[model samples]
Target: MKIIRSRSFTPSRAWGALEIANMNGITTRLHWTDQPYKWHVNDGEEVFAVLDGRVEMRYREDGIERSTVLETGDVFYASVGTEHVAHPLGAARVLVVETQGSV
Candidate 1:
């Protein structure tokens, strides 16, 4: 059993993550970031849950760019081939679950 105190976690660099679990080819991670992640599509799906601070989640739909603010406790679900990026408002902690090795 394990318990992670995400509020006290920080990485030496931006967007670094703490691996929480890996099972059945899926991985769960806790990420700390202040910078924006590059836009990309995942191989399968992803669940991004904000645990602290806020984030502006940008994505493309029907070839048009769109975005939404995800405050703490907000969850964003990205399906397969969903092109998206995450821009944190400040230092934020996010829990992400997705296929292992997916980008």
Candidate 2:
């Protein structure tokens, strides 16, 4: 059993995460980041949830770049082959669920 206070979590680097669980081949992580992540397509689906602060989610759909601001409690779903990136507004904590070893 594990209980984490997302509001008090801090990362040591750009995008650092704490492993929460790994069920089957999927992984659940709590990440604290202050920098933007590179755009990449995941091998499987991904669920990104903003736990604290806000983030700018950018993605490429139909070869066009699109973006949306994700406030606290907002969730973003990215299917396989959907290229996307995340940019935090200041510091933020996010909970991410994705396949193990997915990029």
Give the clashing pairs for model 1: none
The estimated TM-scores of all candidates read 0.98, 0.98
Model 1, C-alpha of 19: deviation from truth (Å): 0.5
Note the clash tally of each candidate: 0, 0
Cα lDDT of model 2 by residue, 17-99, tens digit: 99999999999999999999999999999999999999999999999999999999999999888999999999999999999
lDDT of 1 at 49: 100
Which numbered prediction scores highest in TM-score against the true structure?
Answer: 1
Which residue runs does candidate 2 get wrong by more than 4 Å?
none
- Clashes in model 2: which pairs? none
